[model samples]
Target: MPTPGVDRWTFGVAPLAQTVELAARLRRVTGLALSLEHAAPELDALLDALAEAERRLAPLASADPAPRVGAAVDGDGRVYLDHSRHIGAFNPGFPEYEIVVDGDQATGTVNFPVAYEGPPGLVHGGFLALFFDAAIQHHNCDAGVAGKTAGLELRYRRPTPVLTDLRFVLTRSLDGGRIRSTGELLAGDVRLCEARMDAVQGDRARLPPVSPRREQPGPV
Candidate 1:
């Protein structure tokens, strides 16, 4: 059986798999755009080609299909942002972090490329917060405290460097159905950031019934 929040569609959804691959390629392209030097005068041609490609692809927007599942919260058992297309996804368009769960604890690892840089060689602070948020959510779900984030607090201890692997761990507790979680980001033995988060228990009752079907109209 797959983990509760992990998407089984990862193996079966053709369009999603293709989209994930395309996003991975774009991430590499973004890193190259950020770190490439001007020794070669190819930027102009590259920009022109990108612009033409954008124009050619713009028409596909109108043809985009609606999502197959429309559950509002993760606990509804629908594939969503955390496992699908959001920045926190295991998919390639985002951090592409690897996570493991052990009881009430969750551990994750990620690497930031030049495209995620902010100050010189360091990772952006906002991205660090995003990482913590995702980690907390994963920990909460794995601990069986499914909910939506109500508040998040973060502290930056040092500059997180880019193009290097980083580690994060989260521990969670529950009180009155609210989840309280803490997470930390580290580089080897060095701590970089810390986070505390609170989430309210979601109402699973709002989710649609299993095997729901549209009512057919009778002949007039």
Candidate 2:
């Protein structure tokens, strides 16, 4: 049996894993089909199952764990971790993005999987942009703005490989009611992309309520 907070193979209802396996199998079978007609039905069924699984996992996938950054805010409007670990541990995998803040600077990292591949084994450019967007938002939050993306621009330098670590570094250029930030994504020593963003603090009344997810328990 798996300990608390560690993802383990459960006896039943391993929805995400099951769905991932099924999708992989479908992709393989469809690719090897002798004719287009032979693959269509299996492809259609795979798409339907994948869509349903994603719908069920969306909410859980979107939930943001109350980050432990010194300035982090919890779902109940409380501060959690006063200091955060490195970006890798901060945000593990999937559509999630992780930020590690130090003073006015932050770093983000995301590990793309085969599911997020774009060209062959490369990470999708759209997803790379999403990571930059989210990283900038987290940097803004660290700077005490509590705002959303008002504007963002990205320049892709090279293809980011799926299953490789993509790192982003953000520095606050301006802060106040409106925040201006600059950042970049690196694959190893090579620069993959660069970005800048502006975020304006929205009316508190118009802002959606925040409910932070609970942190997973660490090794004892």
lDDT of 1 by residue, 143-186 (tens): 55457789999999989999898998888777898888888889
User: Could you say which candidate leads in lDDT?
Assistant: 1
lDDT of 2 by residue, 122-163 (tens): 878887777776666655555544455788888888888876
- Candidate lDDT values, in order: 0.67, 0.59
Q: Model 2 off-target regions past 4 Å?
A: 1-94, 203-220
Which stretches of model 1 miss by more than 4 angstroms? 1-15, 39-42, 63-93, 208-220
As a TM-score, model 1 comes out at 0.73
Instruction: Tell me how candidate 2 scores on lDDT.
Output: 0.59
Task: Kindly give the stretch of ten consecutive residues in candidate 2 with the minimal lDDT sum.
Answer: 5-14
Question: For each candidate, C-alpha RMSD in Å?
Answer: 6.9, 11.8
Q: Would you estimate the TM-scores of all the predictions?
A: 0.73, 0.52
**Cα RMSD of predicted structure 2:** 11.8
